[model samples]
Target: MAEKEEYVKLIGSWASPFSRRVEMALKLKGVPYDYSDEDYLVTKSPLLLQLNPIYKKVPVFVHKGKVLLESHLILEYIDQTWTRNPILPQDPYGKAMARFWAKFVDEQVTLIGFRSLVKSEEIDVAIKEAQELITYLEKEITGKMFFGGETIGFLDIVVGSMIPFCLVRGWEGMGIDMIPKEKFPELNRWIEKIKEIEIVRECIPNREKNIEHMMKIVGRIKAASKTA
Candidate 1:
């Protein structure tokens, strides 16, 4: 948190869900800032390299001359700094639960589930793991409009950003319906509701492009498997 006059910039990659998460957070908080899309494959900008030396990843948030890495951490910082349109819960217990789900969504859910969409020898197993995660969420999301209920909150942002990339619900990559309507009706309803949110829709990555990328990865893997 800087003083009265501080600059805020979001350096991101177009296809990155992590970047979109930060972007959505900034927009939701009504924070005015410039977005710089870095083509790391083509040209990793000097500014991005300097800001995030360790990871060299996009969605590097520069606020008041301070660099913040990790989308979830940046989100927490945004809520603390903005104080308006607060995304996190005010109560201690509620806040803790939100944080738990956010972390779980990122590490336990997205990390494993998204990889399954890329390229996997055991596609069935990968799909099963993702389905299990979704089923767990399906129960958690029951009766709640969003993860935070009536209003969108921290956990919702974390999980929602990755939904488009998630197999069944998103139809982005494999076009596999990982969370079937009958099996996970609640989660399906929630996904539709979240998609209608303007900010979320604006930040979501393109489905066709996402599917194309997954296809490329699978093709490459098939070629490599033949060679092996």
Candidate 2:
């Protein structure tokens, strides 16, 4: 085993894509770190609350006692600090594009995908809107093995993290095919390829378990909507 250099710890939940993203980056970069499993659905850990009082969310990364919240930001920090296996692109333009797509994955894909489930009444409209956004990604990934080109990088990690929940099983569990294989051949192929990666296979939650968890989330969202 390699000698530990600095104190590194990650507060995260196994089922959370955001948490998985950070873990994937760490593993890809060969950075050994301690993991604190914070299953927020059941209870938020006191340590997580203390570290990220504002969001009180999982995937709060701690390096040498310095705390960092937000999965995307933590990914960048890991890439910049580790410097061995670069996650983000080296050139300015490539880095900007990576950041742009990563933001799109979080803000657009995640929101719209969840909205489809929350507004089950407007399922058709939501599915259409989601298809439109996925079209952009389909076009972007044309002839490429990944969003980051040959190797998985910033955009890949950001988008790949959501594939199970946002594009596949989570949606499928709700009887929605967010990314139909016929409609998104390239994207679907990319999904298959990414899933084969050792790090990704290790980090992804079990399909049956994730589906059960997603159903609970959908039920809660529906209940909240009814109250509202």
Leading candidate by lDDT: 2
Which 10-residue window in model 2 sums to the lowest lDDT?
Answer: 163-172
RMSD of each: 3.1, 1.8
* Model 2 C-alpha lDDT per residue in residues 25-87, reported as the tens digit of each score: 999998888998976878987888888999888889988779999988899999999999798
Candidate 1, residues 150-182, lDDT tens digits: the string is 898888888877664433333445657777789
Q: Which residue pairs clash within candidate 2?
A: none
Question: How much is 155 displaced in model 1, in angstroms?
Answer: 1.1
Worst 10 residues of 1 by lDDT: 164-173
Tell me the spans in candidate 1 whose CA falls farther than 4 Å from its real position.
1-4, 118-120, 165-172, 216-228
Q: How accurate is candidate 2 locally (lDDT)?
A: 0.86
